[model samples]
Target chain A: MEKELKKIEKVISNLELNSQAQIQELLKNFLKTHLKKSKIDNFIGDYPTFIEPVYLNVNVKIGDDVLLGPNVYIGKNTEIKNYVEISNSIIFDNALIGENVKLNNCIIGKNTLLNCENINIDNCVLVGNVKTKEDVYRIMYKFK
Target chain B: MSEKRKQEIQRIKELESINLARDEIRDLVIDTKKEVEKDNDLLAAQINDELNKRGIKSIDIVGAIGAGKTAILEKITEKLSKKYRILVICGDITTRVDADRIEKHNAETVQINTGRECALNAYHINQVIKNKDLFDFDLIFVENVGNLICPSDFKLGTDKRITVVSITEGEWVIEKHPMLFKMSDIAVINKIDLLERLGTNIDKMIKDACGFNPDIKVITTSAKTGENIDTLIEALEL
Candidate 1:
């Protein structure tokens, strides 16, 4: 397993990573080669609708009126605000999915803050870890 | 003061001294060439010869601001470091921000703060190679000062040249900047992951790029999502 992980890292290190779709594909390929089936165990939040098979790592907070996925993976300590929709997407660690944001076929990067409202993002990769609040807000709004 | 802090201060002082020495060399070069014709072709040939003699392959990564030039360099350095020794020369107006980012991936970097100069020239490369030992590295990635205009006019004598244009810059970029594409060996149409959101016709962009230079290889990539990076590596033959 350690050797496999190292091999995966080596492959990832060689590629320019900017899109979540690419990472998703890489992981899927890795899983296909190694493990037969992958499983996710987590508690879903109240009144937050799930399309089923939604994966959440530990400490992921989902808010009311939020719609999660048929294929969604939220990483550790990420907070999802009200009226947000996410499907077929991967949100990395320490991310804040702002209110009224709709995401599909995308990947939200680590330490990213989505501070905007009423924006629809699809087929995009938001490479977070922005230095300032202004930058975070700026990018969140740029997708529209 | 803390030991770490003292060491950092000393490191900064050494950097300042090195920068000063480089500046003196640049000034000397400029003064010596004042009487001579400003022949870029001659200088480019000289740089090419120097690089060839050292058996080093050089790539010039040219792009506008926010076109993911630094991000691409970071990935390239990370991926290729094990196989080959890599040095990234980051050219910027006044900041080492790009160099600092690349160095975090454990890549050797040299920052050329080209104040008042929009493009990196052969003279800068000549001085850099003269100051540093080129035999140490197998590959050199020169991140040209961010802009599509000025860099087209200047040749840095690299083996391969890649021009990165993002979707955020719009479809007209390739049409507007034809000369850069004409001179480039590869044209990277970056930020394809934003195709849906930006409503950009990536096909037309690719077509336009290929139209400008029939031989220029066009690769669509997203630096944020890590899309088509392997293909790009293959395209570069790295």
Candidate 2:
């Protein structure tokens, strides 16, 4: 990661800005370096330019276009879909989540299909191919 | 030639794309691992609260396909419902027929149609359960999506987690899903009538179950033969 970051840094430093497009690439790459370490801000679509870092933010990356409707609470470049509820759910990537789901302490693998709801998952490592018939409510419900 | 430079640039672009992809995946893993660890602690604290409150007498029967979960549910539900005003939550990713099947046994059927997957959390169960008579019923039997691994990970405010496995599946059924077996409060070994024919030793089932959970109550029954049906009923009296 460090080497890759350094290479990207070199590209940012060396890229000749002949047009607005080249300038945009330089800025995006430059921004991604810092953005990688910090939390992303929330927006409907199209991630914003990197400025300041925040704690517990979301980022919607490429291939994650059309993320959560109303796009509440995003990190940096993390892709979510519409119909996904935003209430203390931390999403990773390529996570093909279904509609009207409440996620807490759930680490969904890349490209895993979470096609259900009321899922309270914790202390579990799902390497994709996780299929459920009903909600897996944990001891967390006891607190509520 | 400029062609060589262009090709070099294209190669660099491709490599950069791949690198970006790798970086994104790695960072997500690191961040996710930390987040899940944090969530575990948060959930533990929340669970501690849930347990101290008035826990509903809901039960989640977890097992694999052909483990006779449905049969045990029918047999046990027939009895548990009589005393507890039971409501059966049937989950089968497709069709309400399972709910209908259980309904014939005189229990209100809640068919959770979440495509081809299971509801491994309590929120969805609570969502549908809230619409019904939660307080009126003494027991809400959620027949989980015939999965041992995923169902055990979730604790659905249930008084008991009944794990069903047919003696025909083998004595090693208890060891097949260690996590599920370990999490279960009760282990029902169905098809005990077929034990001799299936060459299953009851002692092995008891030993394996006890190995996972010393407090695990093991009951042997044959839902088809109606053997030990009374015993299953007696166990649920608690």
User: By lDDT, who's the top model here?
Assistant: 1
User: Compared with the true structure, what per-residue lDDT tens digits does model 2 show for residues A62-83?
Assistant: 2221212111223343444443
Residue-level lDDT of model 2, residues B172-208, one tens digit each, is: 7787778887878888888887866778888988899
Angstrom error of the Cα, residue B174, model 2: value is 1.9
The CAPRI quality class of candidate 1 comes to incorrect
- Candidate 1, residue A58: lDDT: 84
Residues forming the 10-long window of minimal summed lDDT in candidate 2 chain B:
B45-54
lDDT of 2 at A11: 41
What are the per-residue Cα lDDT tens digits for candidate 1 across B1-238?
Answer: 9999999999999999999999879977887666333577678878888888888888999999999999888877777888888888888775568978998877777666554578878766765675456878999899999999999878898899999999999999899999999999999988888899999888888999899999999999987888888788888875
In DockQ terms, which candidate is top? Answer: 2
